[model samples]
Target: MTKRELIDNIARDGLVERLVANVCHRRHRSLPDLVQMVYEVLLNYDEEKLMRIHRRGAINFFIVRIIENLYFSRTSPYYRQIRRFAQHSDILKDE
Candidate 1:
């Protein structure tokens, strides 16, 4: 599959949303932002490489890693944009 096709498949299946929900359960309010960030990161990859990863049955793993890193890594864009601004009480509230 091409980049567009793979992205369409992910979107059609709501893979990003599900992955974000599962991986960022404590940060539920960031769901939409995380999903969008995942897509942005995926969009930067080479299409042929993405297709190869998909063909190897590692696409889900790949996406999940992206979600995990984005939500958990302090240096990640997700942290810089969303997580950093979240107050401690807000995080506790989500939990």
Candidate 2:
């Protein structure tokens, strides 16, 4: 599938809303930002990897995995920072 098709499929499947709701309840509360981040991840996905994945017949699963990895990756310093920031903001709100 093309990139646009991939994004459309994801959104049409309600994965974006589900992801945002999940993360929001779990401490990452920025719904719009998370949606944008998901889109960014999709837009920047490697074409070769996508082709290989498309051949495998479970593209939505792969897409969800990619987004979940970016959102909650323990080893990714950038995602760690985002999680930390979200936690700190939550703490502030509780103050």
Worst 10 residues of 2 by lDDT: 23-32
- The number of the candidate with the highest TM-score is 1
Candidate 2 residue spans exceeding 4 A from truth: 19-27, 74-82, 93-95
Model 2, residue 49: distance off in Å is 2.5
lDDT of 2 by residue, 23-74 (tens): 4564555556667777777778887777677778776577567556766787
Best by lDDT: 1
Give residue 3's error in model 1 in angstroms.
Answer: 1.3
How many pairs of residues collide in each model?
0, 0
Question: What does the lDDT read for residue 71 in candidate 2?
Answer: 68
